[model samples]
Target: MFTNKGKDVVEGSSSASATDHRQQKQASQPAPLSRYESQKRRDWNTFGQYLRNQRPPVALSQSNSNHVLDFLRYLDQFGKTKVHLQGCVFFGQPEPPGPCTCPLRQAWGSLDALIGRLRAAYEENGGLPETNPFASGAIRVYLREVRDSQAKARGIPYKKKKKKRKLMKANLDNNPNISLQQS
Candidate 1:
């Protein structure tokens, strides 16, 4: 170190300059969006576009579950997944032998995922968590209805697969020493 009157300078300032460069780089560029965040932004923009296309241009503040339901129905027009009706020959079959006149609607899983993204986006965009339209009971009921109808129409039963732990527990109940019998 050398001192010129009251000013002192370090012999090696590479580390200091490197840190400064890092700070400047960080300040110049924003962080990249994660997959989920990108999806949320897209969903929010889509909802905003839907609102703008409304008859009177609905505001985000005035949006409700009803508007969400309408948007969901509107999306049905673009769905590519086929959901068989009860009267269809392929109803209740996992794989249809031949194509029928079944209607194409948005898959239940896709709608569920979209609703999840929209719900998160609504809160992230300054909407009150309590007043979030996506959090309404109507939205839940609509999702449930969509899930059930889609399940029935597609003949895919909506049953959760049981975990192996539950089966192990059942075996443990039948034999008190089962837990200690592991080799």
Candidate 2:
């Protein structure tokens, strides 16, 4: 004869057996998770990993020396694997080259070297446009070079004129309270 398992469900004769059957049925029933739900769970787990600083592998190409340096600069500027999606950086270069992978603290000491190299390159070449903030005095120097080159090519002489601004020099030695009209 069948027995009731606590609630009004049919089960085997022994109470223990009845409870076991009920448990088996419950366990056999499929979990109410859908495909979308399962995928969402997986996605959440992966995203969590990313948020926790576990990034996926990135393949990089080391074609140009400049590219390698720029990658290092990018890492120094931004302290993470993924730089914020800014327009300037996007057009500048794509990431991960040579041995470098993750972002690093800005190499403050390298700033002087970088600036010096930039200046030297500009001195060797003409220079970059003034629009480039990195141009430094390179723009003015380049213009001077261009002017000099033009003068040389044309076999014309150019002279630098010094414009002296007459300073109403302050007589600080005299009392400031004394009127200039008295002088």
Task: For each candidate in the order shown, give its overall lDDT on alpha carbons.
Answer: 0.88, 0.41
How well does each candidate superpose onto the true structure, as a TM-score?
A: 0.73, 0.20
Please give the range of 10 consecutive residues that has the lowest summed lDDT in model 2: 57-66
Model 2 regions more than 4 Å off: 1-72, 75-106, 128-133, 136-183
lDDT, residue 173, candidate 2:
36
Which residue runs does candidate 1 get wrong by more than 4 Å? 1-26, 160-183
* Top-TM-score candidate index: 1
**Candidate 2 local lDDT, 1-183, one digit each (tens):** 543455564434467897899999999999887765554454334323433442333222111223323433443555433322223233223332333233344333343344344444433334344423234464345345534543443344568886442333345335466444542
Q: Give the TM-score of candidate 2.
A: 0.20
Per-model clash counts, in order, read 0, 0
Residue 7 lDDT in candidate 2: 52
lDDT of 1 by residue, 8-98 (tens): 8675785599789999999999899999999999989998999999999999999998999999999998898888888888887778889
